[model samples]
Target: MSILIDSAVVLKSYNNNIVSVTINEEERILFAKGIGFGKKFGDKIEKGTEVEKIFILEDEDNLRNFKQVIENVDENFLILCETMISYIENELKEDLDERIHVALVDHLNFAVQRLSNNEEIENPFLMEIKALYEKEYTLAEKVAETLQYEKGVNIPVGEIGFIALHIHSARNCGKLSNTLKSTHLINSIVEYVEKQIEVQIDKTSLDYARFVTHLRFAIKRILSDISIKNDFIKEIKSKYKLSYKIASGVSKILIEQLQKNVTVDEIAYLAMHIERLRIATIDK
Candidate 1:
């Protein structure tokens, strides 16, 4: 008598160490040491194969895009991406959106190639990225180390910011473009506030930190059409007239950029933060 085993049907193969398989009617990318060596489509892999990692992409588009990238990019580079993804999951203690697997891997492949070619990656929103997405930025810095070890290329700090952008976008199941828009909006508002108040923001200040955070959530709420109730909207308008005026200007900027009506309740909330920044400089 011979022993029998249940196995997954290989849907695609990505070299000597990785393969996409369909088992239990779910598509998964399996990674193990030499799992795909001499393996090809329609091969059966043991369901209990001792694997280092298995990525089950629940989203159909993500799975499709993942396979596309895996086929086009080098196996070594894809492995590098897998290493960073594993590290990111370990650091965050949560499974991220599968879209990240598609977006980040594609992004890192291009980034590594650009860096190898000595292309300058410029991030004008670098400071804003650091301030707004601190946790993701920290995680991205660690991922940069993995990139260095795997690819022998040192990821630039600006590229780290881009990684942070990807992480933050995927972590929240949001689009990178939306995050970039929010970052740009926040910086514009900050710049406008400085001009109106004749004061440069102290990025290190706790108050400034809270203000930027507020703006981030504020943009999220506005984009989601989630209005907040500000009981003291009238008081904010009356008491902090200067901040309110500045907030109104900021509202115009939001309307023009977002093309959505901004509630005065939000304007009041913005004024409150502006007032905090304005008050921080008083009697000093």
Candidate 2:
């Protein structure tokens, strides 16, 4: 697909290879060999003519970092990064967050540069990444495979874990914590509730599904630094005392195990869900 660059004017050139341009008055850095060759400042770059690969920076931090990385990176490597992103999206059948474009490209650029210098970094979270994000890890392996095929560079297995982290971060957008830890914490909370109530949960029931959904979002919110304010905290504490107690226990589990603090509003919602689950268990 030909991505049209509308009203783009070249801002600056670097090493006669890369050009910084403003498209629709939005600053972007374009990477292409000889893209900036013979181009002067304030030159108008015709869309689809000189632009071979384009990268849109989403924020100030991204723009600053991209500028730093592009200086040392090769244009072909940038192209390969774009191709790999396209391949990942097509294979996964999901639209990844735009952050991946900058994050993954920067990571791969540095990784390849390190590999060329025989400096390979180890990933401490390899096993955890494999366990938590199996699908993303598998796709990351394919990314490695593509790198070897296209660039003739054999990236180490450890790099797979790093790439998987990028994939995981992109998938979760703004939440870069360990997802496996969250899953374990959620399971512990659910098991604790079941044990405390001395009731067997029907995993096949809709109530169970709803509870799990609520827990998933709760965990996500906690990880994303988002909070839910409890407007009905007093009413919930008074009406659903038992459920509130159970919810309090859940909050403790979150703090002890995941080091996450549940908000009062989150506790209230959890209490309501627990009450529903308790009633369902009794009916069963």
How do the residues 142-200 of candidate 2 rate in per-residue lDDT, one tens digit apiece? 99998878767788989997788778666775444554565577778889999988998
What is the total number of backbone clashes in candidate 1?
0
Model 2: per-residue Cα lDDT at residue 105: 85
Q: How far in Å is the alpha carbon of 196 misplaced in model 2?
A: 44
Q: Can you give the TM-score per candidate against the true fold?
A: 0.60, 0.55
lDDT for model 2? 0.75
Best by lDDT: 1
| 188-265: candidate 1 lDDT, tens digit per residue | 989999999998877545456457656766675576576566778888888999999999999999989888889988
Weakest lDDT window of 10 consecutive positions for candidate 1:
1-10
Q: lDDT of each prediction vs. the true structure? A: 0.79, 0.75
Residue-level error in angstroms, candidate 2, position 104 = 2.4
List clashing residue pairs in candidate 2: none
> Which ranges in model 1 have alpha carbons more than 4 Å from their true place?
1-6, 174-284
